[model samples]
Target: MARLGAGGMGEVFLARTASGRPLALKTVHRDLSREPGFAERFAREIRTNDRVRSPWTVSVVDFSPPDTAPQWLATEYVAAPSLADWVHRHGPLPEPAVRCLARELSAALVSVRAAGVVHRDIKPGNVLLGAERPYLIDFGIARAVRDPRRTRTGTVMGTPGYLAPEQATGAVAAAPADVFSLAAVLVYAATGRSPFVARGEEPDLPALLYRIVHDEPLLDGVPDALLPLVGECLAKNPEQRPTAEEVRARLETAGEQEWHRVVPPALVAAAGSREAELRGLLAAAQPPVYAPVAAPPAPLTPPVPPATAPGTPRPAEDLVAAPSRTRKAVLAALAVALVAFVIVMIVPFGGGDGDGDGDGDGKDGTAPAGTPAPSPSGQSPAVTSLPAAWVGTWTGLGPGTPDADGVARARTQDFAVTVTLHAGAVGDVMGAQVSNLKEIGTGRNLGCTEALELRQMRGNTAVLAAVTSHPTDRSAAIDCPRGNLYLVTMTEPDRLTLESEGAQSAGAPAFLTRGR
Candidate 1:
């Protein structure tokens, strides 16, 4: 069982099928089952509900009345928490998600109306959030357009915040009644508060109903694009409201802009940074280390300008340095010319002896006295390869459960490859497999260990074999897929290159490089 909730009519439990498919089962309250006419109404509602077939409508799978105990109805269980639960914890939803909810629920009502049914109740409690979608629930209160049960005297239905004016007045409702309820639900999702507020000692419910029928909603904070649509939904005359299909189209168009407008720039920057970091980490073949470099000395500050009354003579040191500068320039030029002459003299013998000697001496090519050797260009040493100790299996980030063996088994069955790593290896296994492997596990075989066999190791490339170990495993020769395995080779301490085949195959050679 995954979830449990209740409506005015019954309790709902969400469970999974044998194949792990989810389902929602609703059981009528024992007291309600015993009430006269409840069974007939429930059965009729179920029949009407079974006809709805919109993406937004909750699908009915099975339903049964009490033969010996409480009656129950089963539906396709959506795989997400409810909107009410989401609101309680996350406060109001973003404007886009709220608009999406409103549009989808309205479309669902249109489908129900096409089936000649009216969902007398449309509230947050009855909406289930599915991953990437929404599901409308609690159709047991639905009634056919001409159903006489809707005329029942002194019976008020629907939650206080969502009930339409006609619903409160006992007037037979059409599709617009649900539209009004949908608007209320949207208001709740958008603002975390209902449009109609209950005030004073004995809140005047009649005045609130009157306002809903005649007045415009106080639209603070509501998106301008959605305000007009919401106003149409809350129209006093049922004929004035647009059909659910129109609302769906309008909201879908509005949602794209709202989503873009609300996403924070910081989140976008963080995503970009993470992608860059991951790519760098995955491609690096060698471990990285940092060494501090010496800082350059600051330049000498220039002398400040001297204060002068009209036209004063400069200081003696500044005046004396003028001739000294010309003399120093002449001396520097002479030194450069001497250096050029020496280089020209040595050029006949290939600039210098191969053994670094500048003199013409034959004995070990020694340099002349008082000559200093030039320093080699300064550069950090390159990382050539990963540490030998790092060659072993490693785990990835996810829920830690079912043990390593269990995860391996599941992967072998679904993905057709046994996934393994060396003790400290960073990526998936390489090489040939003895048998096909699965990517996901079933109940009985929840193992996660992968056996990797080291095949060959070249300068920057290593070949490995991925072997599957299962009682029912079968072996076969398969073509290598491109980009399947990456050989990460470290050329220097800070440089790692990834080499792989450009295209992936079931079995293919992979390559890596230190640079483009």
Candidate 2:
């Protein structure tokens, strides 16, 4: 068994399946399982993770059935190292590499939001550097996009230095919180120090939080182009931040071949060497000796059948080689980020359930497929009753929309969206400079105008069954399959919701209200 490292929740191990397929298995510490209400909380977290499916975000593969208690969760293993490992080994990244990292990380957030997930942990240790693309790993603390009331106040979660000012101050960590964390990670990548790091002094958690809430970042070393945008992300006001899509649009001009050669030769050689060792481990006559730790005994050899494979992504070498916790940079054994301040293990499902996520693929960026339809309070009515409140301009910043906080928090870009519904059909536009989402080309404040007919309405649910032509909009993908089948449900008289129907879900149900 190739033991990769440990995290706040459990130990990550590299193991093989019966097919010899590689997987990364994180076994929950036995102590946590004994806690009251842990079983229910664990099950809910799995469901939330299952909703996220993106090439950029690491995918969680389930080996346990619905009824059985899962001892572990497995994810696709990539051969790479944490962003921290690479930066520490190779020094700060060049402008081109940083630009590439920003773009890819933004794109990854695009998917993460699409699946209604806000990864609370966006630190360097959670980011994996692949052969070409950078992947967002460790969705252990991800929360679904929903009504904000569900968040626990003063949770005091996540990494100390990476925590956004709002998060540090015990405010709700919506999408903007993630944006702030990602920006901090970028600063570290570009300058070898967190933007909040005080010069000539050891980093202090409380002092850092105070500075984050009240001070401006010292980023003299950052490129002129990225300075303001990243600063905006680190803004104390969450509403002031831009979305991930917007960031991607701004950086889109950086270049298409940006991802190439982002890695230093030394790290690449190290990765190759680790891969060779992993391959050899598959056939070793005897497994390596277990180096015991003060905590629970390290597994003699990781239990097989459904373990995370090594030489897999985030190669065992991917983690910094510190004995206690390899996965993260600062604390390896206690994997949770909070700098040992406060770590909460339970996965809290946000708020009230709404309409179903139309399909399992998550492409249309809808809700989870099995969201409990409104019951009384939530139940869809048997009669085909349409409320007049549906007519009006509904606007909110969400995935694919500029100024979308979800994109901002995910360390991605933003595209604002506005839709006008006139009882029968709806006209909508998202983004700027580049308005046509079907065939995306980033631009500032550009509007993509398209029409979707509300073909059916039942109870509080309304389905946009077909797309209509907008002859003036050149941004539309003329030849592509672009008719929108996304669902829009009205949970309340004044509230409007939009969700995807395909495999790739877009940043949760885009909750909107009339006129802003």
Candidate 3:
């Protein structure tokens, strides 16, 4: 027996079947096997995993409870190392490879969602970098869509660095949460460090989670096209994040063809036996049917034995000839009609519309002259208006300190400024400052800069970056820490907030309405 690895749950061993077929057999830990509910959950996982069919997902072969011996489950043995191992050997993955990894893993999540299963753990350790393609392993934490108990315990089941905000909060998560985890994994693959690393000694999981839930990620080197999708996936609110299918669709639209590589020989050989075992299990689950044989012809009268010695012979007049040509033609026509009826019954309808016009309207389906054009949501006609005045720099308060009374006091400082819009075009110094000043000031310097670069403005929000000081120490000496930068954006019309560690807010609208 070849030992693969051991964990808290169980020990995985490389084993061979009676026919010399290789397989990976995982036996449940002694302690877990003794638990009353472990068996049921394990059985459910096996059953659910069996239903999942994806090239990137591992296949389950056999599962046996500890009725007479130790409980064990067998899965396809992928020979490649985990993503974590690969990263350890080679520094960080290249940008293209990182994007490729993200696309593939996100597509895998799509499959898992289709199978009615959520892979709660999507960290690097659970992802295998096979020779041909990546595979998602360890469905140990996989729960069916309807598993209430899985959420009730609120167990921190996934890796700390890769968990979504909702997962960290012990909230019930859907497929989007997996996407969030995948985004984090991609970030880690791009950069050697996790995106949410703390400055001090050890990173605080709760604080990191709070940041993930409330703030945008610090994506400095990530590609622009991929960053937006990653941001959507890592949205603080689960509802705001896109679905797995949406992620796959967008990635495909972005031209992600030829991403799947050939499977390595070792992995292919290992997966083959496991797949065969799964087929056997399915075959065994179904019962076989035998067609009835026609009864033997009835015996003729006994008196016929005198003439034929064994059977009586029918008269030549009793024999009937086959149908006539006209009759055969009519029968053929009836058969054809029956086939056409069956096809109509089985084939779906309304599949395609010419030129992809879903409503089946003509190419020029427009309103007549003098008629009002229909607006989205069928509301009042939209009015084109000028940009608002509050599109420039606006500041509020800053973080405060505790008073002598120890009642959690804060200072009423007016150091906060929110830039709604940048003035000029790209490469223009003034416009660059106004556009990216907040991001540079906040992310680069912890919000210590007097003036920063304005990266871009969206609606009422602006992303800014801090400018480098002539002498780093000189800026620090002047009480303006070089690294004290921030990224501030308007949450809505009412509130202007900073994305610094100490988020400051002012002019918060009492009833701020969301814009499209």
lDDT of 2: 0.54
Lowest summed lDDT over 10 consecutive residues: which window, candidate 3? 340-349
RMSD of each: 30.4, 19.6, 30.0
Tell me the spans in candidate 2 whose CA falls farther than 4 Å from its real position: 63-70, 142-153, 254-256, 283-516
Best of the candidates, TM-score: 2
lDDT of 3: 0.48
User: How much does candidate 2 score in TM-score?
Assistant: 0.53
Candidate 3 structure, TM-score to reference? 0.47
Worst ten in a row by lDDT for model 1: 341-350
State TM-scores per candidate.
0.45, 0.53, 0.47
Clashes of each: 53, 70, 43
lDDT of each: 0.46, 0.54, 0.48
Query: If ranked by lDDT, best first, what sequence of candidates would result?
Result: 2, 3, 1
Model 2 per-residue lDDT tens digits across residues 219-329: 877878788889888888888988877776776773455465765666566666555554654443121221211121121121221114543344333232323142233
User: Candidate 3 on 347-448: residue-level lDDT in tens?
Assistant: 001121001111112322122122222211111211122124323545443332212121111122222333334444322223211111122222322233
